[model samples]
Target: MHEFTVTPYAVEGDVDYDRLLEQFGADELTDEQIADFPQPVHHLVRRGIFYAGRDVDRFTAAANCGDTVSIVTGIGPSGPMHLGHAYHFYHAKYLQEQTGAYVYIPLSDDEKRFSKELSFDEIHKHARENVRDLVAVGFDPDRTSIVVDTADADVVYPLAAEFATELTPATVEAVYGPPPNVGLGFYPAVQATHLLLPQLVHGPHPTLVPIAVDQDPHVRVCRDLAAKQRYDVEKPAALLSKFLPQLGGSGGKMSSSDDAPSILLTDDRETVREKVLRHAYSGGRSDVEEHREHGGDPSVDVAYQLLFYFFEADDTELERLAADYRSGDLLSGELKRHAADRIADFLEAHQRRRPDGPISEVVEPYRLTDGERDQLSPEVFDDV
Candidate 1:
């Protein structure tokens, strides 16, 4: 067995995803389960960007039958949002559109504070920018709620406190590795609070958390807490995806902290092209003539994988591109240009729709309602 480590806080070395599923004990999504998703499924699901899951059947059943369903996918405000972050949120929006699933997005500034080198001011700034990008995704305000951990600590903290009692220090260290600070020791409880927030507000309902496969430990720990039956909540199901490989071809998760430039949400056409052409790993032969004879390998081509994973949604068209690449008809430069163009197009639309105004004003409508705050933390409210 090749040694690799995957924790919510870090993913190191090349991950064996099949082995990861076994280690995490999550079920691979079956064909039948895929069929259960509402019609016109997002390409992410169809193409296996999201490959494995836990209790997906129950969430699909709820969606199929018009029962209350919620999606909880969050971000730590450690940096600007990148294409990898957009991938998860965009899929959540697609499901919300199809099934009218309530969507809850949490901005874990607290976690960022504990985990990153940034100050609270810096973290909050990123959180605000992330909110703008999220609002631009166009989640239905009527059904969508966004919570910032510190901004909404009245509810978040109390709820996390309730779950913290159930978490042992050994278990936290085992899953997340050692905590850098006391805040991290309790942050898993905050994550548990995020997963179960939908149920806390609207009563028990099927909730799905779409996240990277490495983050499954967070879902598993939360599931264990829910299973204790202290809270009136059902365990949240998870949709796990392989990492969106970084541009450097390391096969690790795309991250803003990487040495190679990440395709940021703010990148313009020229910036996108520059990054893709300069940094994207090529799977072609050393010489152009050799590449023409043997063809490029799309399996290891960063550009092709980008298009296949999320940018190129058309099944037939994507397959045609793949065939052409494998047959030496598509050169590495041409494929990189194509992927950059597609990515730029997507970002253009997102930038156009991005919300403007004081972050406070823009976020108020999406924040938890006063009544919900009271419900989740009457003691805190009473103190106020």
Candidate 2:
């Protein structure tokens, strides 16, 4: 073999590569980590529901490809979920109701970690709120099935091990390329079995793990093992979403843990408004005359992001306001106030719909018994 080349590029300040990675936040997944999935209707995406990445089309094509139609979706309860998480559930519920697919939802308790400074007990406790939030987002009681991994820590391991043994360590190491932790190796098995849980929970069925593309590596691992299975785990479909930015910065996914950039699922009206007005990036100028002449940056403007991601107002109404804002007539204060008021009001309405619901409450009523059966809905399947 040729000697390894140490190709040099322009050097910045003394680079402590590991320290720099720490200084700059990033995920470990590579460009190829994501799987290709079926493209669901754009409206399904806009409603903030069911998401997988490149893996979606395969699931869609398979459903039409064969006689069976069943799906699997797993949730990570490692941390309390946010509006971002709500999107996935809403979409899953929609697909289940429409298609009559056997639906499986797994709560990933084993994967949770407390704050680096906090204990596991704290993280464990937070799982309840996550369950509540998921329920409130409207997972139906009659149509869905649920499993929480903590119910029996070993419940998932047997299946996961079966998947790993079949897929082999060499195979996993080849696909994922060892790094981060030994856990990632098994994470694929855990993830694969999760998508297959509906089949495991009910019976032989087509399963799909509906999730955001950020979790794509997990799906690739799942698809690989499924292909090698005694059973088929057709490529899990991924419904993807664009990441929402922090209120104050262009980088970093929004977090439930932070107060400033975040307007949480649990935030009260005033807190919502205050967070928006105080921290939202603006589309208006620093001063009046210059702002009117040049307008502002819509890409960085927090209010605009909310309007695009969360607003329920007519598209035309939103479009008119966006045009005016870009023209410099709209002040940042005015836009922030409008967005905060609307977002707070919308969240309050959602909270009211399921007064007693929380993720745990949601998961409890929908929990599935092994060998249980439910009819699939016809709505989820498209004739085309």
- What tens digits encode model 1's per-residue C-alpha lDDT throughout 80-181? 999989999999999999999999999999988888788999998899899999999989999999999998988998889889999999999887778889
Worst 10 residues of 1 by lDDT: 375-384
> Which runs in model 2 stand beyond 4 Å of their true positions?
1-52, 58-73, 114-120, 152-154, 170-184, 201-206, 257-259, 355-362, 370-384
Q: Cα lDDT of all candidates, in order?
A: 0.91, 0.58
Give residue 354's error in model 2 in angstroms: 4.0
Report the C-alpha displacement of residue 344, candidate 1, in angstroms. 0.4
Model 1 vs. true fold: TM: 0.97
In candidate 1, position 90 carries an lDDT of: 91
TM-score, each model?
0.97, 0.75
Write down the RMSD of candidate 2 (Cα, Å). Answer: 9.6
- Where in model 1 is the C-alpha error above 4 Å? 380-384
